[model samples]
Target chain A: AQSVTQPDIHITVSEGASLELRCNYSYGATPYLFWYVQSPGQGLQLLLKYFSGDTLVQGIKGFEAEFKRSQSTFNLRKPSVHWSDAAEYFCAVGRGSNYKLTFGKGTLLTVNP
Target chain B: DVKVTQSSRYLVKRTGEKVFLECVQDMDHENMFWYRQDPGLGLRLIYFSYDVKMKEKGDIPEGYSVSREKKERFSLILESASTNQTSMYLCASSSHDRLIPYEQYFGPGTRLTVT
Candidate 1:
């Protein structure tokens, strides 16, 4: 079975500060990782995904993540944060041909002015 | 762009009542999924269909059943709604193309409440 763990349950950052959300996964084989964001009362939107080839993946709204094989981590990062970026973020790992994803508990991001 | 739409945005049902949640995708995706979201837990897959008439149980499919009569639509059913089933239901679809297989596009979601 595959699983994802997001160490931070909630994160608070200033509007202009840089941010990083940690994610770790337990998978037997090469993992397909993804980051998704959900705003209050809205469905989730894909921030980015890492399938293969690249260790550093770029996503929408000026976000990026680095996949580290040794550490089993795919952490999302942004140089500057905005108030609108406050939302609940999830990390997921996909395995097998069925395309089933195992998601983390989620990290709630709070942007302080 | 892919568009996934659910039948309702909010629903209130009584305990033991039958509930149906419909999902339709416009992009001709080969796969459709039903998931439930809670406060602390992320999305948990209830059921998924790879092709018409083919359904698979996900991690938490005990109290849920699904129907996929058409390629573009997938429906999730709760035989008897319970208070524990009150949560946000999300519908998503993804292409099965080998090149890009797992990026799922989601609908706005239906918030279901059972009392």
Candidate 2:
């Protein structure tokens, strides 16, 4: 079955440090991948997506993800992190023209000052 | 901005009682979805509608039903509210761009509790 996996259940980083949240997928063909962030008591917000893109895709809130077909991975990264970036992040995968997002368990990011 | 709204922010329902959760989207998106969010399991799709009156069962559709008589409104129904069904319910809508791909705009979510 097609699925998205974020191996890290929790991660902590200094406010200004570089951040990376790993995501891997298992799909039959080229898949559409996405990253969403959810704050406490709020709904999931779209961060970035990759679908036939230029491998590296930029998204809102100073976030970007690299889509590597060989590794079957689309990892989210940020050159610098902010205190506001502390939230739960989810990795999702979809196929075909449909937009059904299959999401991972998510990674809780804690940014320390 | 894409806006999706759920009728209730919090709800308390009794077990074995019929419950309805309403969702509305201002954007004329062709797709609408209902999902339940849990701590470790992430978000599970309950049902989705591609067009008015066109509904499809999602991965976890049992114990839930959906209504889409209108394009902008989708409703999730619980035939008999149960404690197991209590969770954060989310509503989302998206438009087809066929270009850079589309994003599903989510509502604030309704946290439901069953007694």
Itemize residue pairs with steric clashes in candidate 1: none
The lDDT for every candidate, in the order shown, is 0.94, 0.91
On the 0 to 100 scale, the lDDT of residue A88 in model 2 is: 96
Position A32, candidate 2: lDDT: 80
Give each candidate's interface RMSD in Å: 0.9, 1.3
Q: B21-61, model 1: which lDDT tens digit per residue?
A: 99999999989999999988888999989999999898899
**Tens digit of lDDT per residue, candidate 2, span A27-105?**
9988888999999888889998887849999999999999999999999999999999999999988755677778899
User: Of the candidates shown, which would achieve the greatest TM-score relative to the real structure?
Assistant: 1
**Poorly placed runs, candidate 2 (over 4 Å):** B100-102
Tens-place lDDT per residue, model 2, B24-113, is: 999899999999998889899999898999999998999999999999999999999999998999999987767645478899899999
**What does the TM-score come to for chain B in model 1?**
0.98
**Model 1: lDDT of residue A13:** 100
